[model samples]
Target: MSIAGQIAASCQRAIGITLARMMSRRQFGQTLFEHQALRLRMADLQARVDLLRYALHGIAEQGRLELRTAAAVKVTAARLGEEVISECMHIFGGAGYLVDETTLGKWWRDMKLARVGGGTDEVLWELVAAGMTPDHDGYAAVVGASKA
Candidate 1:
């Protein structure tokens, strides 16, 4: 599996763990999931995960992964993995910091390595930027244009 695929799977797992914990526990006479703010953040995380999957599918269909495109996906996946897992840690509260049987702690430690793996974020960002055209249509070229 690609790095993005692994990150997506980890994000999905963290979300599941967080949701289960939230629903099973209550704060102020209501489940944590009942809170509006928490739900909104969860929705945003889900949206990001879905978009990452869409990008992966698109790349797979192309049957080619340009260096710039691969860098972009790697950077995105690593950042998203960090963000999603960190948010879950916050939602998990002090329990997240504990050394326990849960995979959250393991994922947390592993995700920090992702930023430096498969090339650092700075180098990848430079690669992505270098591929951008200077024309007015550069935005479209960098993003919406077909890889072919």
Candidate 2:
């Protein structure tokens, strides 16, 4: 999850830089940032990043870190990092592919590591599902009570 968070943070920085560059260069009588469609897309990506950050914070606040919580965050953060980085790359167009000009390509390459490292997304989801099962020792009471 920590590695995933780092990926997210890096992607955020790349997205910010790309957006700033687009805003500085006018296109079609207005900067790309001024386009309603582009603005909405950026807003959605920002919200996803913020959601992942807040979820991680919530998990930390529990004091006792549970495997389920860790798995959930890992899945979310890795997915969000991949999404945000991809969007940033689209915004950058051909320039994002150039390693010398921006770290977007590097970030894109590293994002996959987050998904595969520690535990794969499928493995993490299975962990989460196991935690929710009534037969699972830790969640037995909660799951049982919900059924009644």
Candidate 3:
């Protein structure tokens, strides 16, 4: 999860840099970053990045976390990374899709891999659910006994 958060932060910084470059060119009589819509989107993305950072910090401060909490963090971080990269790509226009044109393409690929590289978002969700269940121990015991 920390890794995912770090990746997201890096992607956000890259997007900021790209937006700054675009703003300098004065596309269509105004910079894309100067538009209210883009500004709002960027704000939202920043909030998400901050939220992920906060979550990570809180977990670290606690010195320990349950499986469900860890899973939740992982899921949130992975999703945030995906969202950040996608938005960055949108800001980059068609050039975002070309690896030779922009690093956003590589970031996008890395985010996709992050989503599936671990236990996967779906598997993590299931782990969270199983851990949250009140009968988790009993259920595990039943399954274990059956395996014997």
TM-score of each: 0.88, 0.84, 0.80
RMSD of 3: 8.2
lDDT of 3 by residue, 1-148 (tens): 5665666577667668667765775667898878888878878888888877787888888999888887888877888888888887887688888999888888888888878777699999998888874778998999999999
Give per-residue CA lDDT, model 1, range 1-148, as digits (tens): 2778889989998999999998988999999999999989998998999899899989899998888899999998999999999999889888886758567888988888988888899999999998976776876787766765
Clash pairs of candidate 1? none
The RMSD of every model to the true structure, in order and in angstroms, is 6.2, 4.7, 8.2
Question: Which sections of candidate 1 miss by over 4 Å?
Answer: 136-148
lDDT of candidates 1 onward, in order? 0.88, 0.82, 0.79
Instruction: Give the residue spans of candidate 2 off by over 4 A.
Output: 133-148
lDDT, model 1 = 0.88
> Clashing residue pairs in candidate 3, if any?
none
What does candidate 2 score on TM?
0.84
Tens digit per residue, CA lDDT, model 2, 50-143: 7777766776677677788788888878888888888888887888888898888888888888888989999999999988745477578788
* Candidate maximizing lDDT: 1
Error of 3 at 129 (Å): 1.7
Candidate 3 error regions (>4 Å): 133-148
Worst 10 residues of 3 by lDDT: 1-10
